[model samples]
Target: MVLLDGLADEGSETVVKPVRFRIGREGVAESVGVDVGWFTARGYGELEPDGLLRLSPVEALYLTKYGRVAVEDDSGHVMGFEELFSRLAEKTANLWRDYVIYMDLRNRRYVVKEGFSPHLRFRVFERGTYPESAAKYLIIPVYEGDDVVVEELLEYVRACRAMNKTAVVAVVDRRNEIVYYTVSLVNLINP
Candidate 1:
């Protein structure tokens, strides 16, 4: 539900600027199609003290593609979902899988963002909370059919533990359904 008009750009990326943009205060950034509530509710962005909603690139792309934000270049050109998405994807390690996990968590009403333990892409704050509290969980995305390295997963748990957050893996199926599991080091001792 976003409106596109008069957005043009010039940059090295050749796609109307780089993956990130220089959205003008009012001249460049249009009133978004989705209200600030849409981003706040999904834990994607925040309305700053200046009344401008600051968003992460991940949130911007996800919302632009699926949620309710529309993006255009500086010259009034409509930016398609795939068009923007492709640009964002170039910056991530596993773009498709990560985005799928991000959207899934957001759709479930949890406030999530991209600041978790290293190697993990998200820090899921408790429900109904947004930027006011510390994150509670760290989530790493993995496909059900993919080979998982247990040692690597253990490291994530250790790092999250040190940071006072729980570590979980979001296992995605072929149908894009997700299931979560905590990764931990199981100490074994003979009785």
Candidate 2:
């Protein structure tokens, strides 16, 4: 509620100056100002080893939608929400699904980042733990009609377990509603 209120401050007189970000030819969005640390401090982008604030497509879109950042093409042309979304989505698989879950989690005050592995969609940190601690949850998004491969899922769960994190499967229905399930490996026979 508080997060939503902050995001949807229609009546607030305070105008937030959007930080400018440039989307390069390689499809990565990088900030162009001193707000790099500011964005990273608030859990919006990752501070790369090269000292650049690199934003995932989902993160850039979310920040753009919230008016916290302005995204432009490599040629300095400003992009609207649809244009940016379309361009970025072309490079990301299941873009809409990932955006929905990312927005939901962010609105709920969770610090979310791109997953470390291919099988994971996101790594979610509890409120106030980001930039200092590891994520507590590893999230994988599953659409309603997707085939559930038990062995693959088990592998992902085991990866999360090895990292001391909870593995969460976020099921996105046709209507875009999400439900989360915590998955764990259970040995049927005693070792």
Top candidate by lDDT: 2
Model 1, which residues run further than 4 Å from truth? 1-42, 46-54
For residues 1-191, write the lDDT of model 1, one tens digit per residue: 23222222211222222123323343223334334543454465656666666655566666666524566666656567687666555555576777788888877778887764337878898986667888998997888989978888777788888988888889989888889998766679888
Going through the candidates in order, what is the number of backbone clashes in each? 11, 0
Worst 10 residues of 2 by lDDT: 1-10
Q: What is the C-alpha lDDT of each candidate?
A: 0.65, 0.83
lDDT of 2 by residue, 1-191 (tens): 12232232333456666778899646778877554655666677778777778889899889889887789897898888899999998888788899999999998989899898657889999888887899999998998889999889988998999999999999999999999999988779987
Report each candidate's C-alpha RMSD, comma-separated, in the order given: 9.2, 3.8
TM-score of each: 0.69, 0.88
**Cα deviation of 99 in candidate 2 (Å)?**
0.8
The residue pairs that clash in candidate 2, if any, are none
Candidate 2 error regions (>4 Å):
1-13, 189-191
